[model samples]
Target: MSHDNSAENPKNIDRANNAVSWDNSIRLFLQQAGSSSPTPGGGSVAAIVAALGASMTSMVGNLSQGDKFAAIHERIAEIIGRMNRLTGEYEQLLHADISSFNAYLEALKLPKNTEEEKTLRRAALHEAALHAIEVPLRLMESCRDGLAEAASIAEECNKNVISDLGIGVILFEAAAQSALLTVEINLASFKDEERKRSFEQKVSALTQEIGELKIRALEVTRKRIAGDMA
Candidate 1:
């Protein structure tokens, strides 16, 4: 049996480490968007926003994990964990966004000299665009849920971390709003009436949900904060 030495190569090791570091840097990059970089763009930014919301929820739960908050800690922790998983899913969605864009780019390069090829390219572009649109739509939904979860925690979590939960709700709201833009932009390119109508309906529904969640979160946070101040 021939032993493969490629895995042991110093350059390969460095490359592997670099990939890991890059993955980790995504979170940092979104945290500091003012800095220049091509990737971790709007989609990644949305993911980071969702992650921040999840992180804040987690912080509140962790702070309340002791006997004082025993009744709610487990439930809050479960919600936080779900949010964290959603955040990770959003990150994966960002990667999918890149792949979806690349597919569209490839489709654009397809030979237009033949009608069959043209049809194929059009189909490819349509599918790719749909994927692009769906990625953000899903993120919007996830962020909307995060906003709701954050609001729930804000209303009932330990007083000390209520502000953090508010921040989480705000981040999720921003993320949802941002993701909705991507969904709308992609939807504009889709030519199918039925599909367009379906997407539009979904967008409308999500928009309403987001608006309601935002209002509810703000109201809860404001009331909690006001009560604390009083």
Candidate 2:
């Protein structure tokens, strides 16, 4: 879970160009999720969640850039700034996703024919699962934080952009759900029941929290929109 800020460096034009170009990277990431490959699995999805959160943050910022909401420029700018930081963090998560997958795949190669080998393989699996767990946990945290940003924007952002905030809320909710699924899937593969129970409980708590946030965001957005229409 090492975080690298280099990906966001302005001098790294090549990396920035390729990452934001929106060509095959996202499609490939999604494709790999469906593929037999394990590397781009949960971690990649978590990174995507973070990306989506950042994207929504950007959307809110864009909507805030004009006339009526000018008073809130500082606040919107802060949200955008945080999203920028999270974007870099998400890129690092992408690397983490690959590393965790590779660790699991390598662990799978341990010779299970011998008793000692079986023990090694089990250890590897546990380690791999732990790595896998980190990806979603990080994503859950990012999404939750992003939700707070969205809430702020929804409360104070330009009325014209109210729908965009709603969209951000929905996107954050989706990211949260995606991350939760990843956590559950990885936890299911764990060999220790105690560890599994612990992780499951945390995941359940996250699920409930996300559900509550989703409901609140939706209600706020709806009322805001209705008020505007009225």
Per-prediction tally of clashes: 0, 0
Candidates in order have lDDT scores of: 0.71, 0.69
- In angstroms, give how far residue 61 of model 2 lies from its true place: 2.1
Candidate 2 C-alpha error for residue 224, in Å: 1.8
Model 1 residue 150 lDDT? 73
Candidate 2 Cα misplacement greater than 4 A, ranges:
1-46, 228-230
Tens digits of per-residue lDDT for model 2, 1-230: 22212223333222212222223476776765575443354556566766776787677787778677788888888998888887777777677656665566567667899899999988987887798787777778777777777776676776677777788778777877877777777776677899788888888887787778777877878888899432
TM-score of 2: 0.77
Q: TM-scores, in order shown?
A: 0.83, 0.77
Residue pairs clashing in model 1 are none
Candidate of highest lDDT: 1
Off by over 4 Å in 1: 1-22, 26-38, 228-230
lDDT of 1 by residue, 124-202 (tens): 8777777878888888888877877777666668887778888888888888888888877777667788988998999
